[model samples]
Target: MASDPWQGHDAAVLFTVLLTGVPTVVGLAVYLGSRLTRQARRRTTPFRTWRDVSLAAAGAALALYLWGLLHVLFLDGQEQAEECERQRPEGTPALVGRRGDFIPLRLVCEASDGRDYTVVIPGYINPSLTVLLLLALLGGVVSLLLHHKQRTSTRKKG
Candidate 1:
């Protein structure tokens, strides 16, 4: 995390991680869940299977997801580094004292493109919790379906 000695606050890393990590796991879980449910049916006709569809979909989703992750992890870091390298001259034109929204550009210099580069920092979203939430939801639905199926099967057995 890079910061000016003067700004006294920073939030670059937090946004970087959440924005990057969330979609990756959510997409994967949805893909696999839909697949497994379809595959496990007792007798499905040819040319249709849930497992096949889910797994196939995962490939495309994963590819697009990786590019997003890379942009967050790599490109954002590069931009933030470049942004921090240029700071405003110290004690010149005190933008803080007389301002709207009040950021010290003197302490934080703008990049060549007139954009402030942001550093990619670690964020809250991780695979474990995302998968857990997915499990809870899908597991509940599947359990209900399975219970219903079992009751039907049992009544037929009787």
Candidate 2:
């Protein structure tokens, strides 16, 4: 048996708050600041194009997904650790397993009131989320470039 894995719960909670809450607050501040600055300038900016809106929406969606992912990876991680601890037998290690990159491996751990756990760590990243994040980034960049080009052409025409 291994030592208690739930000892790091406090640190994980702090890390989760820093990772998720800080960025969300910062993003909101930036957005509100930009809006206030634009309003103060008293410039009647033209409405954004549908494509531009769509790209921004995609970016927002990606950000939301990332927020959820962080929560799941961090907050849920702590919960899982606690659950494992609760199910663990007294005076036994929280984890007991082989330490090697070999097949036919076995891990002895308690989770969710179960006596055993099959921890399968995937070798590859999640392709779907990766693709979606990349697509959001690309769309945002393209939208910026097109908006700049449009502004330049409009200025030239005017």
Candidate 3:
């Protein structure tokens, strides 16, 4: 059996997954719960609307990020290995190894002879994640500001 590349990093990966996954699950639950509970309510308040949109956007961003991570963790190394094997000269014997980076989420194949080839992720993933995160942040801020204004207005009228 092949040894797991992520063996020692299980805890860190699990923590990272949960950090993103929890929000995703929560957002899904909130969406479903609201839908089920408010079947008759066609009109949504600004705060609720913004809050839901923010949660959904955040969830989407996290989910995409998670997908990218999983792709790197599982698929990238194997693919890179194959590419390295194909690139090696017929008579040369060189071992191919993987190196990973988490912060920027990258993997590279290192041949024994000091040559390195980077594993490529899909082009759209990072840019899409960035846009979604920005939308989520904007929505959250608007939601919070609207909620505060509503509360203050109520207090003044009461």
Candidate 4:
């Protein structure tokens, strides 16, 4: 067990919002903006199916999601280090590097009150959901590409 400056449940919620909600909103904006640009270029409205609508949205959402996950998993150490620096109680010796080959970036510190603490700071996402989201994104992209090809070939033939 690692000491978290944030409450566990609160951390989970913050991670969800940071990793999912913000990106989803931004993705939606980009998706709609691209659609509008395509429509303007073609001078016509493009057909959209329920599946296409859902899948495209899903793809955008998932792509942004994976980016956020990567940041949390691999690029958030600096933020955590900053947190440890800002939050550690005063006069605690400089945080020592974690031992072992598999340890996450962390600081082992002893407080002035003589209590030992392991400040294991890291961002998190659910692995299972990440896998599922990736698969769905792949499927969505394949389906969309096939759909576009079919439409273009039909337009050429007609």
Task: For each candidate in the order shown, give its overall lDDT on alpha carbons.
Answer: 0.40, 0.46, 0.67, 0.49
Better of 1 and 2 by lDDT: 2
Which is superior by lDDT, 1 or 4? Answer: 4
Q: What stretches of model 1 exceed 4 Å from their correct place?
A: 1-48, 76-158
- Quick one: best TM-score, which candidate? 3
Give the clashing pairs for model 3.
none
Query: Candidate 4 vs. truth: CA RMSD?
Result: 11.6
lDDT of 4 by residue, 1-158 (tens): 25543222234543665667666756666765665575554753233443345555565545554444444344244554555567777666665432111123223343435554544433342343455456556666666776788789999999
Instruction: Give the alpha carbon lDDT tens digit for every residue of 45-135 in model 3.
Output: 7887888888888778777777766665564435656655666555554654655555555555565677655454555777898899899
Which digits, one per residue and each the tens of the lDDT, describe model 2 over residues 1-158?
13644332244544565577557756755654565565644752333333334444454544544443343344344464544455556655445322211122212244333345423223222344456556656656766777788889999999
Residue 116 lDDT in candidate 3? 58
Residue 78 in model 4: lDDT: 59
Q: lDDT of candidate 2 vs native?
A: 0.46
TM-score of each: 0.26, 0.36, 0.65, 0.30
**Model 4: how far is 123 from its true place, Å?**
12
Q: Model 3, stretches more than 4 Å misplaced?
A: 1-23, 26-33, 36-43, 76-78, 83-98, 108-118
Which sequence of candidate numbers ranks them by lDDT, best first?
3, 4, 2, 1
Whole-model lDDT, model 3:
0.67
Candidate 1 pairs with clashing backbones: 13-121, 88-106
Candidate 2: minimum summed lDDT over ten consecutive residues — where? 98-107
Between candidates 2 and 4, the lDDT winner: 4
Scored against the true structure, residue 88 in model 2 reaches a CA lDDT of 59
Candidate 2 vs. true structure, TM-score: 0.36
